[model samples]
Target: MPEKNVPTSPPTCPTDLSLIDSTYPVGVPLTATYRLGFAFKTINLRLPVILTKIIDQLSRDKNEIGESCGQEARDDVKIVVGALAKFKNEMVTNKPIYKTGCKIWDSYLEHIAQLYFEGVVEDVKWYFAPWLHVECYFYKRIHDAFQLSNHLKSFDPFRKQKEDGFECSKKSSAQLAEYVLSSDSSDAVLQTLLEVGLWGNRCDLSLSSGEEVSQLGNLVDQLQGLRNFVLCDESANFWKILKDAKTANPDNPLTVGYVLDNAGFELFTDFCLADKLMDRVDRIDFYVKTTPWFISDALKTDFDWLIERMCSGDCSDFPVLVKLAERWKGYVLSKRWTVVESEFWTYPHAYFEMQDADPELYSTLTKHTHLIFKGDLNYRKLIGDVSWKPDTPFKDALRGFCPAPLLSLRTLKADCIAGLRAGLAEEIESKSQDWLVSGEYGIMQHAQ
Candidate 1:
C-alpha cells in the first residue's frame, strides 16, 4: 500500500459533493458537527459500549462461560483479550488505523485514499468517518480479533444473546406457530403475518446497544394499531408480484429470496411468514450473515439453532412449534428451503456496487423472483446511505441495482428515507420531530 500523509485539516473537494440534507453525500462530513449528534454519539458511546462488552466477554475465564473447552479455550481467551484491549484503545483515542489482518483491509486502505481524493473527511478516524463505513468497519475488526484466535477462531461473542433472546421469545414464537399451523390461506392471515414480521424488526439488539430484546405483545392484535406507522405500504404490490408469478405458472413455483436481518423474534416471525408463503413459492432462500455482525444479525448457526430448539421437545409440549419445525426441517432436507451465506453480505459495498464488484453474487440474486431486503442497515446500503429526498422514487434511488424485483421491509432507524408521498414527510414531521431516527415508522417499499 502506498503511503499518504494525514492532512492537518479536511481537504477541499475535487468532485461534486452533495449537500441536500435528504441526499447528502454519505462520505462527506456534515458541517457544524454537534457534540450530541447521532454520528458523534454512535462513535463515542455506542461503539465503545459494544467494544467494552466484547472485552468483558473475552476477559472471562472458561469457568465463567460455564464451559471448560480445556487448554484450547484458555489460550484463546488470553489471545482474544489482548487483541480486543488494543482495538478498544484505538476506538477511544480515535487513533489512526492500523491495517487489520482481514483480506479487505488493503481495499479499505484504498477506500481511505478514495475518500480523501474526493474530499470526504480528514482521514478514516472512527469519529469522522461515514456511519455506514465506520460501523461496518468496527464489526469487521471484531471478526478479525476472533479470527486471530486459534481455538476461538469461529467463536461468536454474540451467540449467547442470540440463543437467549430466542428462548425469551418462545411464547411469542409458539403463538405465531399455532396461528400458522391452524390457519388457512386467507389473505387476512397473509397480511397479518406480513405486518407481524415488519413489527418484529423493532426488537433489534444493535439499535439497543447489544441488549436482548424480545417480542412480547400480541402480534396479530397489534397489527391494526400499528397500521398508521407504516409510512409506505406497497405490501399489496409485494403480494401481487408473487401472486402474479404463481398465476402465470401454477406448475412452476416462483423462487423467493430473503436478505435477512436480526435474529431472535424477528427470525421467528420471518419463519412464520415463510411458512405461509410456502404454498405460493416453490423455494424460499434465506441469505444469512456468514459472520456474526451488527450485534444481532442472523447467521447460519442462528437458523439451525432456532430449528433445533423448536423441534426439540415431543409435539405435546408445543405441538404447533414442533409441527412447524418438522415441516421446515423437511424443507431443508429436501432442499426446498435453503440457507445461503455470502461474504459479499458482510462487505461495506453499497447495493449499486453489486454489479461491478461482485457480478457472480449479482447473477445469483437474479434467480430469485423477489429479493426481499430486511431491516435498517440493508435499507441504508440499498439507498447508498445517502440523504435522498424523502419522496425520491424508490426505483430512481436504487440507481439500477435491481437484479430482481426488490422489496425492502425496513423500519426507519436513520435519517435517510425515500419513496414517500409529497407531503407525507412534512405531516410526519409535524407530528413527531425525530420520526426518521425513531423505529416508530417503517416502509414496505417495492421496486423492480
Candidate 2:
C-alpha cells in the first residue's frame, strides 16, 4: 500500500502449483529451489518491497514517531530505516543469513543450524533455505533493527497498515456484526459464520506484502457462491467437537483457545465468531505474537487497538458494532477473554517442535477443550511447511503436534496443503493453474 515508493515494482508469485512430478520428494521442506515457486518470488521480490514500505513509512513519519517516543524519535527512525534498507538488500541479493545475536534468535539459530545447515549456519542463504525459517528470520531481523534503538525498541512498522485495513472493511464488518448478534446459535447459523471467518483470511496484508486489502459487501450473502471454493469443510465436525466437549464435561466449563492470525477484518471476524462461541465455552484464550510478525499478524497491541477503536470511534450509524464492541470490551474486563503473549509463537519452528521447545506452552494449550487456528501461515506452520502428497490426511501431516482437538480455518495462500480427497488436488489444478496460492480456496480442517 506504500504507493509505488519502493525502488522496484513488487514481483508477483505464481498462484499455480503443479500437483504431480514435484521437484522435491514428499515431506521435504519447501524452498525457493523451484524457480517458479511462491517461495522464490517471495524471497526475491515481495519481501524486499515489504522492507521498502517500512523504510518509506519510517522516513515519512519521523516527526510523528519522534513526538510519540521522545526527542530521539527522528534519529531512531533514521537508524531503523538504514538497517531495514540494508536488510532489504541482503534479501534481494540472496545473502547468507547471519545471527542477530539477540538471545532468543541466537538460540533459535542453533536449532536452525541443526535442521538445515548441519551446524554450519554460514551455509544458509536466503533463497535455498527452508521457506519457513528464512521468512520468519526475515521478520525477526526487522524487529532487531528497532530493538537495537533506544527510543524505538517497541515500534511496530506495520501498525498503520493493519489499522487502515480495518477502516477499509468497516461497512462489511458492521454488516457481519449485525448478522451475528441477531442470529440464533443453530448449527446452520454457526456454520455460516464460520465460513465468513474463513473467507476473512483472504484480507491478509502480508500475503500482499503490505498492500491494502479488505472484505467487501455483505459477507453472509456471498457465502452461497463461495461454498464450492472451500476445498475441505469440517464445520459439522467442529460443532460436534464443541458439543461433545460440553456434554462430556457436564459440570466443568469448556475452555476454548484461539491461535489467532492476521489483524484487520480477519481479526474482526474472529471476534464475531468468538462472541458466538462464548455460548458454548466458559472462557476463550486468545494467543498473540510477542512482537510484530509476518507484516500483519496479530499482536497484543493490535488486539487492544481494535477494541478501543470500535468502542470510541463513530459507529452511530452501526449501533450494533459499538454494542458488540462494548460486550467484547467487557469480556476482557471481566476475564471471559484473555490475551496471551508467548515467545514460542514467534519462534522459527514448526508446531511439532512445541513439545520439546516449549513444553510449558504446550501443556497450557492441552488444558483447552478445543483450539481454533486462523489463516494460512499457521496452516503452513502446523504442517511443517512440507510438500506432502496432495491427499495426505491432515492428522498425519501434523506429525503428532496435537495438544487438543484443533481446527484450522485457512485460505490457501501457500502451495502446501493437506487433507484433500484423492485426485482432488489434481482436479482443481487441471481447472485453474492458480488454485494453490491464490487465496481463492479455503479449508476448515480439524484434528485431535
Best by TM-score: 2
Tens digit of per-residue lDDT, candidate 2, span 1-448: 1121212465533334322323556778888866657777677677877888788888888989878887787787878888888888777666778888777667777777787778887877776688998899999899989977988888888898899888888899999998988898877777888888899888878877887887779889999989989889876777888888778878888988999999988899899988888878899999999999998899999999889888875666778788999999999998999999998888888999899889999999999989999998899999999999979999999999999999999989888998999999999999988788788898999998
Tens-digit lDDT string for candidate 1 (276-343): 88877889999998988998899999999888888886335777888899998998899888999998
Which residue runs does candidate 1 get wrong by more than 4 Å?
1-37, 64-68, 103-105, 116-122, 314-317
TM-score of 1: 0.89
Q: List lDDT for all candidates, in order.
A: 0.77, 0.85
RMSD of 2: 3.7
TM-score of each model, paired residue for residue: 0.89, 0.94
